[model samples]
Target: MSTICLYGSASGGIDRRHVELAATVGRLIGERGHDLVYGGGGTSVMGAAEAAARAAGARTTGVMPRALMEVELPPEGLGELVVTDDMRERKAEMDARADAFIVLPGGLGTLEELFEIWVARTIGLHTKPLAVLDLDGHYAGLRTWLEDLVARGFARPLAFEVVHWGADPATALDHLESAPRERISLPSSEILGSFADFPDDRRERP
Candidate 1:
């Protein structure tokens, strides 16, 4: 079974709808005969997803940073828990274990994870598929912003093309499973060309 890495909020302040959404994603993962890996938090969206996945018979693995043990304890009955020295290692562990990724509505930390994975995909670090559950237009703004970035040449169009956007869990998972892994070709000349036009100023900003 493929292991799906989930990224979402760990804060207790998120709306109930988001919690339910996370649970749905989890349930679908298990029902489809897949496994789960996520941040080892027992509260908020992270907890909800893990709980539902475990209940549905999916093997759940919680990868957490040791520093967050006190703040975000893992829930009881997790199939496995992998502790790391820091957040970077935690993310790396999760990335290594999962075959695909899905994102739920979240705050700063979630966005950081999403962007990092997307950047990694662009640079050929991994060819795994990723998606954002955009139920009820929650991620519509972010989608538009990303498109704008692509339009302005700040982001690669292919990078955006690889991300599957879905409004439901089952459909998103299906798309991710079927998503093709394409070889990325980004030469240094194309990437560094923008820097060539910049004025070299050795002065420090006030």
Candidate 2:
């Protein structure tokens, strides 16, 4: 019923498994009657997934920064193409529009966006579901690194609690769609605000 933010690489051209997973995410977004909000690039995995969703007749919203759009074309097929000032603004826009988040395989950019969402949840800016689409165990090393961080003193086990990971897009979407919506509290605001103070510290769990 609502939109889910999809975070992933706009590059890499997508391998077979990545493409299949992206397509599956798109199909589920459409079949479940939820809208798709994604990076508005016409190349790589971003295009593949958004195209899949659009082809299936889902209302697709593309959020892009002007810089990325200049580097990569804005997808022409979007139901709503929102051009933002920059990458941070683009993320903020998507954060406002999406009810939940689903991350696919991506590079630094993908990690960056998901980190922002996790921080938002931790600090109480939002309480929406956040999930990772771990296709082909692509995120295995990162997950391990997170565990290692938790073992150390740099992060909280509960901070990592913000994310739900899955290998299957169907189950991922199901969890996202079923997440209980809640109102924000002052305590949550302080938690999210702490991240702005601890930008360097959010990379791992304590």
Candidate 3:
């Protein structure tokens, strides 16, 4: 089984469409027998997604920064909860636990998580599906920008293709499970930097 990491807003303003889709994501993850791996925040997208997953009897795990936990408690229930020192630690822990990544409507923090995972995958740190739950063209502008980067030769075309987009949760998962996960060797390529050889869970702060 693979752990699917979802990146989304904890408190950003959300549209009703996004909220409904987020709940469906949790249900799908459970129904498909995939576990939910996400940030541990009870108030926002994280909470909504996990709640849906829990309702469907799917396993869920949370990786949280201790600073955030003092205020935004984790969802009421999760199969696993991990607390870390800082943002870096939180990201690393999520990376350590996830085999794939997904994104939903979110703000800066969500974008940050999405980019870090995108960077990690682009540099061959791990090979897994990175999907964008593209509800109501929520990511249309960013998608166009990324394509522009590739057309301008600022990024590899394949790297720009890292984001798989779909309008609904089922289609996203269909894309996610369509391919076999690829595992990269530590230091497999120099593109990202050292630590490729360190164990999958041992990346150092950059």
Candidate 4:
């Protein structure tokens, strides 16, 4: 009965495997009787996932920024469609609605959403589980970099534990469902300082 938010590419021409994985994740969510929250795009991975979820009887919700309405194409027949003034508002709504998060292969937008949610969880903003499905090793480099941060003493051990990675959708969902419901309340400044040397340009301003 949890509301799971999925973050992924909205582009119409992403890799076929990624799209298929997204659809599979959606079907699984529906089969488990969980609701889905996602970006309200009617193209690419997002569209394929939502379509599958709806077909399987999952309650689907979509949040879209007004500016990207035309570009992303608002999906139809969702249980709910929330249109916000900007990207920040859209993300906020999604975060507030979701009980857990699952990230599929995507680009900058997807990365931004994942990092922000992870940071929020690390700082005790929420006690929800976060998972990344690494379809075709798409997140291999990112995982390595995160591990390096832990090894370098930049990020706390809890930071590494906040994200659960799986090679496929089923495994990721299993990890998420079995995760403990406890929020890590580390000092916000300390958590922020861990990424002090992270590249400024890589940070997205919402």
Predictions in order: lDDT: 0.90, 0.82, 0.81, 0.89
Better of 1 and 2 by lDDT: 1
Clashes of 2: 7
Model 1 worst lDDT window (10 residues): 197-206
54-167: candidate 3 lDDT, tens digit per residue: 788778988998888866678776788998999999888888888778899998888898888887787777887788888888888988998899888677766766667788
Ranking by lDDT: 1, 4, 2, 3
Say which candidate scores most in lDDT: 1
Model 4 spans > 4 angstroms off: 187-206
Q: After superposition, which runs of candidate 3 have C-alpha atoms over 4 Å from their true positions?
A: 182-206
Per TM-score, the best of the predicted structures is: 1
Higher-TM-score candidate among 1 and 2? 1
Model 4: lowest-lDDT 10 consecutive positions: 197-206
Model 1 per-residue lDDT tens digits across residues 92-163: 999999899999988899999999998989888888999999878888998899889989988878877888
Off by over 4 Å in 1: 187-189, 194-206
- For model 1, the local distance difference test gives 0.90
How close is each model in CA RMSD to the real structure? 3.4, 6.5, 7.9, 6.3
lDDT of 4 by residue, 145-168 (tens): 988998998777888678888877
